[model samples]
Target: MEDDGRGFSFTVGSSELVDVGRDSGVWDVFVQAEENAPLARIGRLLDDVADRKEIFVYPSITLGATDVRPYYTVDNDLSLEVARQN
Candidate 1:
């Protein structure tokens, strides 16, 4: 991951060290929600770095909080997804 004073960016990889290309899965990225706030999709990652060879964009901004940050999640991450969605 990297921050260029304009935004946050990063690549996606398998935590299991397996191939993420064959499946062509995408990771749903977001900005971490704070109290009384909502989660928002910033961008997504398609497959792994080798598979897509693309740079995902995540524009950074102040969420009026002191510790807000970016978040990356796979499909159906209910713990975070549900709370934010509801």
Candidate 2:
């Protein structure tokens, strides 16, 4: 949820959908989740990219990759979680 100072924060939820972030014209802005944990849309990422944004809608419908590992962990944890925590 940290802003990279790029004006728009990474949006995993739609401004009109999940009810996260503030409407900032072209894009919505979000802050880093206060208490990020597994199984939540924390600011975890892959290849220096956040993958959660695509999960706002069903991965299949939004053209997001569906990985059983992230949502369904052996410990029932997220494969991608807060980068700082990782």
TM-score of each: 0.23, 0.18
Candidate 1 TM-score over all chains jointly = 0.23
Candidate 2 structure quality by residue, lDDT tens digits, 1-86? 88777454453532242232322112222355446833333233444434434443322121122121123233222432211110
What does the lDDT come to for candidate 2?
0.31
Worst 10 residues of 1 by lDDT: 77-86
Candidate 2 Cα outliers beyond 4 Å, as residue runs: 1-11, 14-59, 64-70, 80-86
Q: lDDT by residue for model 1 over 23-60, one digit each (tens)?
A: 22233455654576888666344345432212322333
lDDT of each: 0.35, 0.31
Total clashing pairs in model 1: 0
lDDT of 1 at 16: 22
The candidate that achieves the highest lDDT relative to the unseen native structure: 1
